[model samples]
Target: MSKARTVRFHEYGGPEVLRLEDVEVGQPGPGEVLLRIEAIGLNRAEALFRGGHYIERARSFPARLGLEASGVVEALGDGVDGLAAGQAVSVVPSFSQNDHGVYAERAIVPASSLVPRPEGLGAVEGAAVWMPYVTAYGGLVEVGGMRAGDTVVLTGASSSVGLAAIRTAHRIGAAPLATTRTRAKRDALLKAGAAEVIVTDEEDVAERVRDLTAGRGADLVFDGVAGPGLTDLVRSVAPGGTVLLYGAVSGLPTPYPGFDLGMPAVSLRTYTMPETTRDPERLRRARAFVESGLRTGFFEPAVDRTFTLDEIVAAHRAMEAGHQVGKIVVTVPH
Candidate 1:
């Protein structure tokens, strides 16, 4: 057995509930691999899970806190093949939050969750890229039917997923129109690859979207904040457009708006990373898209901030504040 440091929460609350604790880890069991975590990515899902607002409630306390991580395979369990010790790999969004997480110095993960890090990407970028890029690729490319010359709308445009979607849209020759309620984030969003920035607090989203598309409206919308504002989204989308609703961060009602008389033939599809996670072919394509972008310098991530493992609470607090322009990452020492 060896000692591993991990971040855990005893009860659901705010970021204060997270604590760094030392624990014992045993040898990897069958189908599992022991990983020496080098870097961990912070996601809003962790904050939601910590605050007891995620779609599913935690089964118990001392719960683990993250899923995306870059680590080296330190040991392999019986029956595990195609991976060896000392190989660099990343933990994708394939683990269940109820039973496992990656916020530790060393933890056992399923071998299937491992992906070779993108060539020339460091641990921090490797950990930072997976969840957002895969989710964006899955929702935008696989599920949303994105194509060249299409117009994509992204709300919560400063979040990691939002930023990834913007880059992905631009990479595929689509016009990306992004939205933020704060005026301060507009320029940052544009610099991060958004084709147009919509200030929802000052300008009408539908009006701006109509103007940008020459009155045709957006072809696809990747929305994280789904609520009453969905009315405006419907107004901004073109006929037969697709709104890939992935998150309900607004904490408001998300009722189906089928009764709206002015509604176009928009296809409202709720999405998550599970679509790619469950399908090998989808996963293969998603990784290829991300890798191509990364190799060509089109997938450069905007890192808003970085924190140490001991400062997990502050990292969570920063994430919950909701003003970051890109990814928030936490680094782990060897």
Candidate 2:
């Protein structure tokens, strides 16, 4: 209809800043489409944005939240093509936060960011797939040059993206050695496709890698949690190996110890999914890779919990608690 429920925050703080309100929906402009948002994917970026700690700060009050969502196409703007009303679709959060967001009952999105929802997946699962899969695909395949038999160390193995990396590595025949903060999640990480789980609190990550890989260290490291342990991670890499720094859970600057830099053989690189999406060729390659994985059952978005529109605060709290084994999703009634 004409009015929709939207999530916004007037002030930057904790989850308490979030407010749900009824907003009027305007007609879609050229290259835009109206959607009945069925499910939304909760991302750390949204939390960071809400807290005013992300790279992009809020320019105005009552700022919107969300990027990834799945819905049915309700209407199309002028010049839109190759889509019809009632078609199921997943929307990628590739545009600027200033221009668009999807945490609403109804949303206007550019057709360019919309893709046909893969078969065998519902709206909630559809919303959970894009970011993690794309980030893993781009980092491991495109940037790391991971292949069969390569050894990968995945940090923050409990995050949705980290879990996806484990699955993708297994599908490619690469060894995914994951690290978690405690043994409480050790079993779940192993079940999620990790070849081995290293409990950082109980064991040394670099020593464990040496033991697992026969002293060769990891061929690549998928690092999402870059804190004081970054030094240990740097030491865990094989000579000439690469480390992909994606996120910082401790909110601390990743340290590069002197020994890590002395060796020209090792490297550290930071990656963001938007880097892949911003390039036409890279975007096409990533999309094809993930699409094939989805079709073949090699990759699936595992949702650890689901929340309704009313429980947004609890959802964020759960996410911040770092207890979820997979993605956190928010569902809306039709």
Q: Note the Cα lDDT for every prediction shown.
A: 0.88, 0.89
Candidate 2 RMSD to the correct structure: 1.5
Q: What does the lDDT read for residue 219 in candidate 2?
A: 95
Model 2, 192-260: lDDT tens digits are 989999999999998999999999899999998888898888888999899898887778876876465
The lDDT of model 1 is 0.88
Q: Each model's number of backbone clashes? A: 0, 0
What's the TM-score of each model vs. the native?
0.96, 0.96
The CA lDDT at 112 in model 2 is: 82
Model 1 Cα RMSD, 1 decimal: 1.4
